[model samples]
Target: MRSVAITGTRATGHRPPDEYGAIFSAYLRPFADGHFYIGGAKGIDSLALLWLAGNSAAHLTVVVPGTVLHQPTEAQQAIARTRERIQDVVELGAAELDTPAYHARNRWMVDHASMTIGFPHADEPEGGTWQTLNYTAEQGKPRLIVPV
Candidate 1:
């Protein structure tokens, strides 16, 4: 089966809910039959999880740098709301929630997935979403970039 790793910015305040819903419907719907590995954070992660859970039959895996409790309240609530739909939750169990830990979690997801779909807000060279997309490129995996 096709498997995908999703990466995006945590800041998604600029857009309205309907815009995101439309974006997800167009981009994520094509891959709805595949398994998805999400970051389990705010922004695109939580939004994608919510949309996928409600709209698709894909196997969902929510991965975190730490535990779900350590994530933002919004992310936790998203996970809780979609608990039944999610097939798994992978907690890396990192004590320090730093950039390295997050990168590791991203890499872990990318390593397991056949491709990656990134929704970066801008052309940020140092952004985590960009980093994951770059890493996927380095690993010789396919990537679909969708700027939000």
Candidate 2:
């Protein structure tokens, strides 16, 4: 099966209720048989993970910057429930939630996947999500941007 990486903004301030889950499911449906690669961050990452846990048959690999402990409480709960289904948990030994480490983790996801699915904010043109999308394009990988 192919691998598809998921990346998006960490901010949930403007996300409408249930919108993220709907968008994530729609974007992921095409890759239902593929493995999913995601950084276990809050916001979109956690939302995607929860959606995948309930909706897809795909294998999951959560690539964390440091440890699972660093994840948001809700994400940690979701991971615990879906622990049996996860194929791998890659801890990249990041000392903290620094920009460089997150960027490195994003690159790792983009490099490993056949394509990337992103939830990006058009207004914010220079964040990690945008950088990951740019990297995906630079790598010549297929990318799908779910408009929020």
Candidate 3:
């Protein structure tokens, strides 16, 4: 089982079909049933979690920045419910209403995983996704970029 960390923009507002397709094609295809570590958040993270939950992979871990229950968002709540079924979700810190120390949380994700798959070009100013990718690169970690 190869553990790969997934990250991306939460506000890119560009959830194109190809992006999800690429995730399955480029990342999930090569690995066996239970071999991915999904860093959970909104947008891309939620999508990845939902896909894996239905696919029946028992090794999926949803890593969140804070208490998953308190992370308020319709998509997040829905994902959280599905995530409970998976049984490997982890939270890194106390509950945060906003994105407090979120970038640091991203860095933690990158540091722990062997590789990171993300959408670094989906947004501007190099947000959490970019920081994570950059951190992984500096540490000589591998990366697979998802389409925007």
Candidate 4:
């Protein structure tokens, strides 16, 4: 499987829906032919999951740092909205939902996938998103960096 791990920011309110649609179309469409490992968070994760669910036939996996119920209501709702289309929901079952737990989740995805694509907020540089990208690079895999 051509697995791709997608890591991005949770803040996407700056762009309109149409703009994000176009961005996904241009950057994510080509990679949508295979399986995807997406963090089950708000913003890019939820957006890309919905887009791929509707627009492609790829297998989708949503990986959460903890149980789905532990996530924010919005994230849980997003997963619920597209439950039928998702192929897997991986809950790492971390006791505490913190930065390290999230970083561990990101590392898990990178370890499972061959490539990574990150959509970081333009101004932001350090976080789980960037850490994921760095791990991907450390693995000597291809990485597509797109700042939104």
TM-score of each: 0.98, 0.92, 0.79, 0.98
What TM-score should be assigned to candidate 2?
0.92
**Candidate 1 lDDT (Cα, 0 to 1):** 0.95
lDDT of 1 by residue, 1-148 (tens): 9999999989899999889899989988999999999998999999999999999999999999999999999999999999999999999999999999999999999999999999999756568999999999999999999998
RMSD of 1: 0.8
lDDT (0 to 1) per candidate: 0.95, 0.86, 0.68, 0.93
| Candidate 4 worst ten-residue window by lDDT | 121-130
Candidate 4 local accuracy as lDDT?
Answer: 0.93
Q: Which pairs clash inside model 3?
A: none
Query: Which residues of candidate 1, in runs, are more than 4 Å off?
Result: none
lDDT of 3 by residue, 22-98 (tens): 66656666653545666666777776667666655546776767767655484567565685665666678755545
Candidate order by decreasing lDDT:
1, 4, 2, 3
Worst 10 residues of 2 by lDDT: 17-26
Backbone clash total, candidate 2: 0
RMSD of 2: 1.5
